[model samples]
Target: MVTAFDEALTCLKDEKIRITPQRIAILEFLTEVQTHPTAEEVYQAIEKRFPGISVATVYNNLKRFTELGFLKEMNYASASSRYDFSLKPHYHVICESCGKVADFYYPKLDDVEVAAAQLTNYTVKSHRLEIYGICPNCQQVEGE
Candidate 1:
């Protein structure tokens, strides 16, 4: 089976981008992580394995991956930019207390783009939906 990592490598190869161990480690880390981590978080997680890996290397690889459409870069005004590897159609629920992000699949929202284009007569290139609320963990902590 063609894994996501393999596909990512193929994309880089197609773009004539040189693949290195650091880049591979960065991609592997992103693939394994469920949370949307910032550039600093990614660097911290992988630095243990690659002692000499610089934060700039992580940031640059992430930026290149985002540019190549292998990953999505999520920027929030209140928090640092986070990276997501899932390319499937989904929305995010953000924890207002801890700034945690979780993905939820909602097929119905796919039609929103069509509806928006019809209603506004504007070309809708894409859309993002984020629901913010205190997560269950935070609520439990508050109850205690």
Candidate 2:
């Protein structure tokens, strides 16, 4: 299977999107970090190696990646937006107290899409579910 990095780069080349060293670094970061990180977090991590790299670079490329379907932008009412690199269909589980995000998968939920399509005039092309609650680590700390 083509790696996420390969697929994204291929898409960019096929679409005539300009590829830059900073963008490549950002893509590498996202592919390796695995954590769903905000733009600021990405900037902080990458700027040391590329001191000239600005947060705007991170934000702009992140926006472009999402527009190209290379990444998924998530909103948690955070001051910054988080980006997910995993392209597979899945749901998000966000910790209410800690602001941590993790993936949640349940194949049965696919049925909901069909039901939604049946009940509404609009076509249901995709779906996402976000669950909020205290995470295990936070619960442990709070219990202490």
Candidate 3:
């Protein structure tokens, strides 16, 4: 089966981007993770596998990937931007306490976009919805 890593490599090849060991490791790491990670977090995770790898490399590749639409860059006012690998339409629920992000899908929101376009007579390209509250883990810790 063609995995997400394979597909990403194919896309990179089509774009004429050089495929290096570091790049491959980065792509594989991102594909396997559901947790939205910051550039620093990504660096910390992969640095063990690739000794001497610089954080700048991770940041640059992440920026390139985001520009190529391989992933989405989610920025929060309270913290550093996080990278999300999933491209499907969905909203996020953020943990205000720990800054964790989780995805949720609601098909009805698509209709809201259509209604908005109709009401304003303007083209709606996209939208973002973020619901913030303490996550379960944080709540448990608080209770304890």
Candidate 4:
């Protein structure tokens, strides 16, 4: 698996854009923390390691990576946006009680994508499916 850390290093010499230490730090943090953290979380974690790195730099680098198809931005009823490295089409299940997020994979979604493309005639580039509700742990806790 090509991690964002490795990707950052590999793209250093190959990417059309210039790479900075700040960018590398941001990518590495995102790659290491797979919880789909927000920009603030990433900034806070990386700032201690890369002193003087501003939150704006992290935000910009995230935007650049997403534009380059190296990362993805997701919003889940949170105050800030979340990011993910998964490039493939998959779904997400969010726990309403605790705000926990988990990935859901379904290979058969390709058929649905094709159907959406035909119906909209817009050439579906991508799609997102999020199922939101209380999770098992939360349900169990509430039951008790």
Put down candidate 4 lDDT per residue, 1-71, tens digits, no spaces.
Answer: 96656765676557777777777777777777757788898999989988898888888888978877778
**Model 4 pairs whose backbones collide:** none
- Provide the RMSD of all predictions against the true structure, rounded to 1 decimal: 1.2, 1.5, 1.1, 2.6
Over 63-87, each residue of candidate 3 has an lDDT whose tens digit, in order, gives 9988888878999866699999888
Per-residue CA lDDT of candidate 1, range 1-144, in tens? Answer: 998889999999999999888898899999999899999999999999999999998988999999999899998755689899998888999888888889998898899999999999999999999999989999999999
Model 1, residue 54: distance off in Å is 1.3
Q: Which model is ahead, 1 or 2, in terms of lDDT?
A: 1
Residues 6-58 of candidate 2 have per-residue lDDT tens digits of 99999889999888888888999999996799999899989988999888888
> What lDDT does each candidate get?
0.91, 0.89, 0.91, 0.80
Clashing pairs in 1: none
Quote the positional error of residue 79 for candidate 3 in Å: 2.0
- At residue 47, candidate 2 shows an lDDT of 94
Clash count for candidate 2 is 0
lDDT of 1: 0.91
For candidate 2, the 10 contiguous residues with the lowest summed lDDT are: 72-81
